[model samples]
Target: MYSKFLILLLLSAFCTSCGSKPETTRPVTGTITESVYASGVIKGENQYQVYSTVNGLVEKVLVSEGDLVKKGTPVIQLVGKVAMLNTENAGLAAAYSRISANGERLSELENNISLARQKMNNDASLFERQKNLWDQKIGTRLEYEQRELAYSNAVNAFETAKLRYNEALKQLRFQEQQSQKNLQILQTSAKDYIIKSESEGQVYDILKKAGEMVTPQTAIAIIGDASRFLIELQIDEYDIAKIKIGQKILVNMDSYRGTTFEAKVSRVIPYMNERSKSFTIEAVFVKAPQTLYPNLTCEANIVISHKEKALTIPRDYLLDGGYVLLQKEKKQKVSTGLMDYQRVEILGGLKGDENLIKPQ
Candidate 1:
């Protein structure tokens, strides 16, 4: 009986100790800044992947990885033997389509025109002589009439020959023009085989080496503005609505340890990434470092709002979404406002002297 009594006494003592234990803090006026976190890579302004435009062996690479180049400067050259052959063939076709005296077809037409003209002149002279004879009654009427008919037929033949000659010439000219246009197209395609920079910038990398087979889809190199840079960040969709252009950002990078950089949002890409469920954003440095390279990973905290002094409490002290633990284990409902990752603002039902317990 004495042992049972001792066990009951110990149980009661344990329950009392559990009820008496307390961890508490009073609501205080303090600052809170709401920010959205993002991760991104540092990239040069206008940075882009350069691609080859023809399928061939890379004959040469004119620029190195770090070479600064101007727009339209040649960066890579392909073998282009096929393109060159095609262009030359087109040029020859254009040149040959132009008809000249040496062309048998054209010579035939010229001969017909000359022969018809000679016949016309002869018939006209004969008709004139015959008409004069008929007028003086020295020639038969039948003979004069036949001569006039011959003259008229000869004139018609001459006119027809001239028209045929002109049409043939016109056809030849049309053919020549078509050939010339085809040659121009071929030449342009051949020129494309020599990959050129689209913008003035430094080459970040050369993906294809000399003698490597490359196609139009193959990346030849990367280039971008060497003196300027911008940040490409991916922000969570949940936080993107609050992100706006011109908002200040606090940037941190592994490359620059123990340092933070200032930046501002320059653009917000509205499209969401299907894979990451995030939106892409662009920012420019307010005071960039002395130097930066392309593709450097960085982290940023986009400032959404800030309060100078507000009724705040440690985030850990809150109980669930709408309440806090009060004295004597009573649940107190407090109206909450802006919150950071570590603290929450109490809009109502909490005061500076009232104790809010941190649940253990």
Candidate 2:
């Protein structure tokens, strides 16, 4: 009797413990995504820092901040007296070569040519009369020889005058063309003194004031196509390789707090920034926000992979060797696929209905 009672008590205690064991949650099907974190800024299409091409004093600023301008619109005027003077001198030289070249010097050559022809005519007549006299034996040989020598000298003089005229005309014409070319070069240089917008946009800011000495490297203003905007991202070197053009980006902007926007990577600048150790990426809005401004701070997640329905569990529930604790403290290994910060996808070795224990 005593042995039977001891056996009953042990059996009742074991059954109570089994009946009171805690329940566990089952794995559920859900969406999972793998992504990389990135930070960036909003910018307009063709956005850029404006700079002058020449170093000079800012003579005048033509456009104010937020002023709308057209392409080829003058933004800043620089003072360059030397450039203007060079243009003026070139113009004067071109005019001299074209107009004054045919003026006095050419006229003198023309007159000289005419005079030489007339003298040659007179000398030829004398020479012919003397030759006839000699042939008839009516004059001394010395007289005929002297007339022939005079005619030869006249012919040489006329030819020399004609050659000189042609040479002078060529020289003057060449000078005119060269001077005109020099004028054009000087005019182009003068244009550098006036900074113009390359695209139509509003001036975001002006960095120079009147009387300030500015260099070609100095920023004068900011401009872009205001109606269009894109995101400029600076991704760390380690993450750049995984990023590619056309990747979907999940964006969060500082300006638009609590709101998430969507964008697609448009460009990935190939070279790494040696100093910053980062790479640049460009993205355009898929469904842009209602509005955007230049240089707005933003954060983005470059999606690498995603699944609409996946077997997922809290990342903390996964242990070393890809094992998961199940009901009754059972352990099973699982293969993982896409994973994010909070959860990981189980590709195999687990079913959706299996109860999983919350990690202690």
Candidate 3:
């Protein structure tokens, strides 16, 4: 009986030793902020890629990276040999088809018309004289009939000459007008070879080099406002609905380590990126860094809510389904409020001084 009793005592002590004390924490009064995390890059205001409107060999890169530019400034010149040749050919055609250049042809038609008019007049006078003589019974009938036939032929010839002159004039005028329009079109197309800046800003990058072939699909350079910058962030679709314009943002960048910058959400893109399943948002700096560049990487937290002096405990102290363990290993449910990475605010079911055990 004593042996069995000693075995029982030893088993009790072993069981007690195996059951370790659970870790514990008490609710504290402090500030807690609820925020949504986002990752993004810094971009210059109005940044965009420059593309050529026409395909050609890059004749020269007119502006280098980091150069200040004005609106309508020529940035890149393309080799436009073919376009130039076409323009020149069009100009030649225009000049050759001008009314002045074809004046000799028109003048020849006019002279024919004038000569036909004189012949018609002379034949009519002869026919009138022959008729008078015939009526007075002094001329043969054959002579009067021949004069009448000659006058009729002369009148027909005159009308045909006038018609030929008018048709020739109309054809010449049409040729001149068509050639002018073609020349204008070719000249406008030739100007496309010179790529110009669409905005006044700094040149961030020159993507194409001299002697490189570029198409309308290829980017020629990068340009944007040099003095202003903004943050472009991608928020997860799950958290996107929580985001709103004018929300406060805390920004951190690898380039500027150990510093957090203040910013505000300026815009939210309504559309979500299907491939990434994220929504894009933009923010402007409240107090910007002195020096900034386009495409600098950054991460940000958008503040959703904040509470000052709320009863809070470490996040690990709360178990699944908002339950916490008491000193006697009793489970108590708590209402939650604002939460951060480290702490969560307790809204109910826990007093300010309760000792809560962390979840195993």
The lDDT for every candidate, in the order shown, is 0.92, 0.90, 0.94
- Highest TM-score: which candidate? 1
Q: Higher lDDT: candidate 1 or 2?
A: 1
User: Over 4 Å off in model 1, which ranges?
Assistant: 1-20, 99-111, 124-145, 319-321, 328-330
Sequence-dependent TM-score of model 2: 0.81
Higher-lDDT candidate among 1 and 3? 3
TM-score of 3: 0.80
TM-score for each predicted model, relative to the true structure = 0.87, 0.81, 0.80
- Residue 142, model 3: lDDT of 98
RMSD values, in order shown:
3.6, 8.2, 5.0
Residue pairs that clash (backbone atoms under 3 angstroms), model 3: none
- As a whole number from 0 to 100, the lDDT of residue 128 in candidate 2 is 99
Residue-wise lDDT of candidate 1 within 1-360, one digit each (tens)? 999999999999999998895778888898999899999999999999998766889899999989999999999998888889999999889888977632888788889999999999999999999999999999789999999999999999999998998898899989988998999999999998899999999999999999999987878899999899999999999999999999999999999999999999999999999999999999999999997989999999999989999999999998886899888888989999888899998889876789778898
Show the colliding residue pairs in model 1.
none
